[model samples]
Target: MKGQDYYIPAAAMAIALVFKLPALRNNWRDPLLRSVCVLLTLAGAVFTFAAPPTIDAVNEWTGIPNFSAPLVYCLMTAFSASCLVLMFNWRGGPAEEIRATSRRWISGYATVVVAIMVLFALGDAPEQRLRDFDTFYANTPYIRVMIAAYLLAHNVAAMTMVAMCWRWSLQVRGWLRGGLVIIVAGYAFSLTYDATKMSAVVARWLGHNLDDLSTYVAPPLASAGALISAVGFVLPLVCQRTSDSWQTWSTYRRLGTLWHEVQSTAPAGTPGVRMSWWSPAEIRVIQRESDIHDGFLRLGPCFDRRHRDAAYEEALAHGADEETARAVADAAMVAAAVRTSAADPEGTAAEDPGEGERVLIMADGPRDLVRISHALRHSPVVAATRRRATTADG
Candidate 1:
């Protein structure tokens, strides 16, 4: 792969990591968050160090030939371990079990990373091979073992990821399942990467040169696999958050009709709860609902059960379902109460409560409030009732 291929993914992972930093800071002890951060960090490091330009620069800077080879191998090994640890945390078993499993994986990969460094230190590779280190050193003593060890570690991680994600994907649904399926595909690419790299190395040991496979084919495959897996990890989180925000905003909008109607009849100079413009959607929704219920309490004296009963019958006659009819009835009564409250600001025209007449607002929750709001905006029966009330008032 070209330098841009490596650097672009590195930059992308950096951006993703930046986005998660705030949440990570807030919940640093959260196992899943920690795992995600570690995975992104290691993945970015792997890509950044694996780029040909960066490899040459590191070798030149350190004055150690092919120093980047072991460094990149160590980072990739750590990245693989991070992926497994993330999966363990994400799958969510008992906390202690997940911690133990993650620790073991980390320890094993740490050993491999150390072994790669030791082998590289012992091996003599005065000639620098930035892009084809594995192929160039395939016949060297300790370097050969170092190359094989890293590849075997990477291959095992990829196969394990594919199997785990595939099995888990089948057991889940929605965005999580979709993400797992993509993860499986990503790891499948990773396995192909290992296969090509290993193939070239093995061919070298047999005195044949398939150097192009490791030098060219394998880099692109590795880059593609990492980028795809990053997307798989991020897709569910981004999409789920977006979906939740949309739902909250939608609820806030749906409640607007009823909220406005009630607010219009609120007594002049009554104390009101004010929220900041930048409040979260959920907070805004709760505030609006609270204002609506407060309006209902203020308009309680103006409620006439007869208006609701008549509108309910009219709605049923017009073929509204029972639930819709109930919504329409509640909407009609709210509309009439708004008119009555407007005419009698002192509430002098309020009727005494009839025994067994339940207060409509108190009888239902937020969902019913949304249904009534929708009915208030669209129900023909409620519209007719509002027209009649306006006429009677005029």
Candidate 2:
């Protein structure tokens, strides 16, 4: 019988419409994202129990009186609009693109939702509740058959959702993608759950009704969990970006350090400025400064003074006595100068996550690196050594 089925479908309805909302349509980075996701969860929950019809009949597990059409639609609808508002208002997409791809997701899901609700609402016509999965599945094929179409279609859609998630898993970095891959695997496993039920003979062999274990209830629970887990894919991306944004200063410091490092590296031909040229003592200091101020600049300039002081203290500790301390202090100053320069493209400090000092020679013509080598050959130290060796030979 058509019952509380509409609530789940209705939620899908609200989210689909939200996809088209002006606010969420354009903005992706808005801060209210978690709230929106929570609403989605609520909507999913409402859909679950609501779709099952209420019956005065005793449930196998609860032995409690069950009521048909679970009153989910009416009760959940009361909050659906508000939930939609919350969802549509949160942010996660480029302004040019819809903030969340979930908007489109809801829209597609809504087709089934609307059909399920409409069927449930219509099936209850004559102002009476009709209770039977058989009637709903088979008899309705005579009417608009919208519900039937949606049910089978949902299977396909579920498969498609898993496929999309699978494809996305290939593109992103980190374990987030792998986590999503697991989620998609769950959906895949779920799709096969119904069809692979134990045969009646097998059920007898196993001392259980396959239907008892293979009830309609379990899949939805698992599916919902899978959907929620799939949502984690978005979280890491959000947090990592936020954390990175917060570290702009540290990133700047890193780049600044790299510049000084490059300077200290000196040209390769002339005992060059690379870390390789520095005594082990010097490289240790540069690396230490790089580690300390890693992402500090992203928070903007109005930061606490204590951080700067902390950095100074850190430098001193690493300096490890007079000469090294002097060297460390010089390294820190060079990095600080880079932080102030704002010469980095778009004020981003270093392009790489870990920046080091090195001279990159870009040449349009013949080997330019060799020219520096030739110049190094004629330097005072080399020339004087050559003369001394020649006098000894003579």
Q: Which pairs clash in the backbone of model 1? A: none
- The per-prediction tally of clashing pairs is 0, 31
lDDT of 2: 0.40
Best by lDDT: 1
- Candidate 2 residue lDDT tens string, 166-199: 7767877665575556657655654553233223
After superposition, the stretches of candidate 2 with alpha carbons farther than 4 Å from their true spots are 1-39, 42-44, 47-108, 124-147, 193-217, 220-231, 234-394
User: What's the TM-score of every candidate structure?
Assistant: 0.91, 0.39
Weakest 10 consecutive residues, lDDT, candidate 2? 363-372
lDDT of each: 0.89, 0.40
Q: Candidate 1: which stretches are off by over 4 Å? A: 27-29, 351-360, 363-365, 391-394
